[model samples]
Target: MQQPAVPELAHTQTRPIHWVLTATAVAAVVALSTVARPGSATAAQSATGTRTTTAAVAPGTTGVQFPLDCGPVKALVVKKAGADLDGDGRPETVAVVHCDAPMGTPPDGVYVLTRSADGRRPRVVATLVRPEDRLTVTDFAVRARTVSATLLGYSSDAVPSCCPDLRTPAAWQWNGSAFIRSTGSAHSV
Candidate 1:
């Protein structure tokens, strides 16, 4: 059977991100698997018995990568937007950080980082989009000083990857201090 529809985001501004976002999420999983982990567990099983083997990080060798340390970040994002969010015309960044252990669950966060003179490092000026409020991020968009994320219903062990059930389009704008989702516009698809 064919999959169900993924409703486009509320505003037309966010629609372009749909295909890009969906493909990225799927690609993230496939891409990360190829990166050979120096030391990880392996399972060996035969008709007789099953044995498991694991290796620890070799003293100084960093295991995965920075973000991969948590989980393989699919469509890894540590920055967003190429425009100056502060009107300083210096440009800003948006990233998904502080994820849960398994990652992609509620309680995750989206951070807005602004350019700093100390270096090219971007400082976290705002934290927005918690997992508890919405489902998994299906897509995202940034425009007119607003950040929009498209969330689709997902369960830990439920739901086939071929079909996601619902879509809630949320938009959050900087309110002088933080990024918060605007009221009402969520719907199922």
Candidate 2:
């Protein structure tokens, strides 16, 4: 066999000390990695520099007396969505309520609810859709300080209550003073 170009060095031989040194180097790297870590996460908004340790609870629909008068039957909340509709840190609830009628389709009243000054109860802040409008609320949602819904209504008085003939997509956004409604053109359903 031809002689190799380089001679074997002493370090090339495997020994117990070499194994111990390798293990020590690996252990040191692991220990140092454990000591160096990222800081604890925080729930804070960078824009407002507000630190929210606990989540803000939205206003609840229970016990809230909506502006609608349901007579003997109680007013029922059909759907609800919560968000910061007024740019406040606290969340407000947008509720779709109607009379708990035994039969026939009842008109829905979309109301914005906020916590009272004493935080004792949720009060109606604005009425997006009044019951008198005779409209049913569907595909409802509250996002980015806006309330959106698809309103179902009758095109004329001849249309039966069981089936709505007109469908309109509507959205309400807070304009600092009031919630401005932007309604899409109605279409027959």
Candidate 3:
């Protein structure tokens, strides 16, 4: 074979010192990466100059005594969604509850649950749907501090209890003092 045009470079030739230097550089990079790290960030700062990163836990529906009076049957939470509804940092839970009956469809009652002043237990703050309304809740959700749901009900007294003929889309939002309800046109199911 013909001789190469350029001579071999020093780096191309591997020596014992080259291996030791390459290992040292890799070790230094790892050591520096582990030693230097960014600090944790705080979500909000208070007037007292204290930083808080902990978020308030959303209220749970369990053990909450709703305003509904279920004499023999216990109230069961069929659906629930949690969010910061009233612009408060703490989150509130909107629960769809109904009496656990052995047979037949039970009317659902929608209640907004929040933690008590002591943050010990959840309490019903608002009632969006009453069991007396004879409406069943469907597609229930809480998004962007607004509660939206499709309510199913009977068009008239003659309508069978098992079948709801009317379907209405409803939404509720906190207007400072109370929850304001807005509903869409009712249509036959």
Candidate 4:
């Protein structure tokens, strides 16, 4: 007797469906756990009166009230560099604030916040670089009251709109009045 023609079941296998459903159910459980179910971040935040993230710091700080309670804020970072840039005794704050850009571009601003000699009223000492779309400052460092940034896409055709290649470095030093371009290399932080 001739063997009956058997279609290959590789493409139409039914066991794979079972595995996929199982994986999906596992993922759903994990996702549900992260929500405000019981012991999640949302629940902990609600239990506490104060916002759990960055609180208003002590005196002489930039007072960066990270309002995490409202929701997930975008690209706004505050790096408290303990270096006393400008030869002041107090440390300065370096903040990367988000800038307006086109839909595909990512632009941000770097601000050097300095406090008065009275140790209060922190104000922006120098805006190292103004906000421009498609430009990126990958990393920054302060040495001898100087600021150098690992910048990308500031020049013409340096990087793409979204994915920036942070290879080129730029330096900015305080010229007694403002942060001027200086000579230095930016290392990845």
Q: Model 2 compared with the native: what TM-score?
A: 0.72
Alpha-carbon deviation at 123 in model 3, angstroms: 0.4
Model 2 poorest 10 in a row by lDDT:
38-47
Q: Candidate 4 lDDT (Cα, whole model)?
A: 0.57
Q: Judging by TM-score against the true structure, name the best candidate.
A: 3
Q: Which should have the higher lDDT, number 3 or number 4?
A: 3
Can you write out model 4's per-residue Cα lDDT over 77-103, one digit (the tens) per residue? 534453556553345676665533335
Clashing pairs in 3: none
Question: lDDT per residue, candidate 3, 89-139, as tens digits?
Answer: 778999999999999999999999998987789999999999999999999
As a whole number from 0 to 100, the lDDT of residue 102 in candidate 4 is 30
The Cα RMSD of model 4 versus the native structure comes to: 12.3
Tens-digit lDDT string for candidate 2 (4-103)? 8999777878999899999999999999999999764323666678666656778789999899989999999989998988887778899999999999
Comparing 1 with 4 on lDDT, the higher-scoring candidate is 4
Candidate 2 segments exceeding 4 Å error: 1-52
Off by over 4 Å in 3: 1-51
Ranked by TM-score from best down, the candidates are 3, 2, 4, 1
TM-score of each: 0.44, 0.72, 0.74, 0.48
Specify the poorest-scoring 10-residue window by lDDT in model 1. 56-65
- Candidate 1 C-alpha lDDT tens digits along 111-155: 566544553344556666544443456466677877777766644
Candidate achieving the largest lDDT: 3
